[model samples]
Target: MMIANLTGMRSFLILGFPGLSPKHYGPVSALLFFIYLAIAIENIFILTFVIFEKSLQKPTYLVFCHLALNDLTFGTLTLPRIISKYWFGDSIISFYGCFTQMFFVHYLGSVTSFMLLVMTLDRFIAICIPLRYPVLMTNNIISVLCGFAWFIPLPLVVAIVLHALTLPFCKSNIIAQCYCDHISITSQACGENVKIVQVTTLCMAMVCLLLPLAFIVFSYISILVVILKMSNAAGRKRTLSTCTPQIFITCLFYLPRCFVYVSNTVGFSFSLDVRIFLILWYSLLPAAVNPIIYCFKTQAIKEMLKKRLRKTKIGIKIQLSY
Candidate 1:
């Protein structure tokens, strides 16, 4: 078996939206730039609000803070390169760089998946086992769960990334998508071992993506049963309200992924441009809308933003008078 030397540098070109017309580049780049900016600012606001507000430091809010951080990191890792690809025409990345990007892209995704699961558990306890929720989801326990969500995916993703790095990439170095990902990069490797990469990728998807999705579905079903048992209309309404945002976010994250995975597993084909667009849509859309969903749906966050805006207005008035 031939081994690729890790010491030598290899680079890959990220082809963003193949056959994109030069005329549409400016509008597309501008739109993406604003979207990236919105994601950054919105997530930062969520993190800051959760951290500084004493009333918002419950287990639920802590999870939101972690999610905001995850979105910020995911957006930061992905958008800049693609933005530059469209704006400045800089898309080539070094071999190690590609691996690094690929690792975090999947790693953070796995973390987000688990975080959503953790959030589901939080909601389940609060709604289904209200009497025991305080004991079950104590501050210490929530902290531990948060740590697990962030760190548990590390070893699994590391193993996969190392395996991909060792594969000989003697084929075309041009990636069809705007970012480096496990499947896109692995597809370019030249050898029978490529089949191993494909199988492993599929297994990783099942483990990292499907498992969390299953747990989320189960958690929601349990919550629904509990809610239905509640005879008090107000109580039932409150419980459903608390759950709505999470359900929306979870569906946003998982549905597109499920589609992509099933399509690949069944050998369902899509045009290259369509595939790239879907990948970009799922990856970026969730990050962009997550904070917005929370802000609009969660009363606590909405009130906090209202107070902050009022304070800003008062400060502006004082400055104008001066």
Candidate 2:
């Protein structure tokens, strides 16, 4: 029944949107579809690299691994389903299946948001109190942080799923996006999603997003104050150089999130295409962009990638020699 609901709604969009018409946006759509394919591929390599490589076992790399995994899940939550609409044309999904997608969409998002906060805290301890870095971010503590990242969102998702089971089907089931996002469900909402909006916004933006951003702000501020007081000019410069990339990456995540929170609250009544397009821009683009930023922005990740490439070539040569 849930699958039927999801399928019927997706079929409606494929049939109704006339989005494929080759007039204005066709080229743009085609370009985005291809870009998403590359995003999917890059994230796959990143995830695999993080998972199988013992060299990436440091605290910083551990966070990167989790980020890569979240990126894979984040992209999967929407892109595959969207790609299917174009490639397969309106696939069927059970009601429970829709719940599953919705759950993951929330799940990955909640985790990513929390991960950003923890990443900030990790950086905070490392930079501000360098003497205690080892004792501060222990593996046992990180496991607890990881647990909080995931465990916090379950109740909200369970609520959404339970809500889905109760929503009456009239001729009212129209999903405007390529996939079912929470906002789309709210647009078709038959019951209490006002709280969903408030709580989810609070969780996603305030607790997870804004709080970390604030920490990033304060952490960097504190770091700068310390740098100013440092007697060794060379030490201060080195610290700033190392800190610059992390700060830039924080901006990349935070700026867009600010926009998303405002847009979601203000533009709830806009046309379906407009609303969904905005949501997709916020949700999907960040996940794809983060790895690129990490590679380009952070010296450590760049060096790691280069080191891995060298190892790959060495392995290839050995294989050929045998």
Candidate 3:
């Protein structure tokens, strides 16, 4: 009732890293701004390369395109507002604004997790069942899978935000974390039933994180068995080479997340600062690093970059000759 009365007027104050000193806010905000810039530029580079390079159009790179786009959207949804909180002291976010941010944060996370699963499945099909790779995985099928990955999480996340909105927020309007999130927002709800929302959010997060992980585990195991049986050492090496980047990316995305959730479940505690650091570490670090992984680990992208450089150099040389 109270929350409804203040519907359009309701807003929340975001307190980013509550333990940090006022003096450090400038440095920290600058650092975050640069990181956000890097994430944007890197992911945009990948998307542009995938768009223009016909040679790179395949199931694997298609998934990379989706991952890059997801990272861009996720970073945009999360970083700038928090950056403002520290840099300009613009900490207030309105009711609908906070809910909108929370919805996309969870929604894009689910999309990334599913995108990783799709990457693993691409590898599984390529290595585990080589003959059917062409038939089982095609551009059209990849397109459909990408579509489902983005679409499937919409209803679940909407339900979460809607439920959170209905809860009476007679408690404090100050959010302790950097950005609006399901747990952070719901913690400020004033009612005994808030526990129900917490439990359900936890379950949803576990399913989103763990279910893709289970399939990833199964896919890798099958991939490994096939790789071990290959008579040709060169082929085995090549196969492992192809799988390694995705493996690095998978570990990057999932391991920190698992550690945090597991620590919470087992009664282990971190300082609020440390907990916030870990959340940002897992959420943002992967986006910053993923493009680097694709650029360095994938041979095709490397070759394309090399060709572009060579062309640039030749053009400069021709001008010098003139």
> Least accurate stretch of 10 residues (summed lDDT) in model 2?
7-16
- Superposed by TM-score, candidate 2 places the C-alpha of residue 243 at a distance from the truth, in angstroms, of 3.8
Number of the top candidate by TM-score? 3
Clashes of 3: 0
RMSD of each: 3.0, 4.5, 2.2
Sort every candidate by TM-score, greatest first.
3, 1, 2
List lDDT for all candidates, in order.
0.88, 0.65, 0.90
What tens-digit string does per-residue lDDT give for candidate 1 at 1-322?
Answer: 1223434336888888987998888788898899999999999998988889898889988898888899999999988898898898888888889899999999999999999999999999998888999899987898899899999889989989988877777767787898999988887787678789778876986788878888999999999998999899999999899998899899899999889878987999999999999999999898999999999999888898899899999999999999
TM-score of 3: 0.96
lDDT of 2 by residue, 1-322 (tens): 1222422343223222334453534454565677677667767776776667666666766776677778777776667666665555554544456657777876677677777767777777887898998998876787678778777766756665565555533334556666665655555544454465535544553554556567667877887888889899999888777766566556666676677667677964556566566667767776677777767766776888899899999999999999
- Report the lDDT of model 3 for residue 116: 91
Off by over 4 Å in 2: 1-33, 91-93, 191-216, 231-234, 263-274, 308-322
After aligning candidate 1 to the native by TM-score, how far in Å is the CA of 241 from where it should be?
Answer: 0.3
lDDT of 3: 0.90
Which of the predicted structures, 1 or 2, would earn the higher TM-score when compared with the native? 1
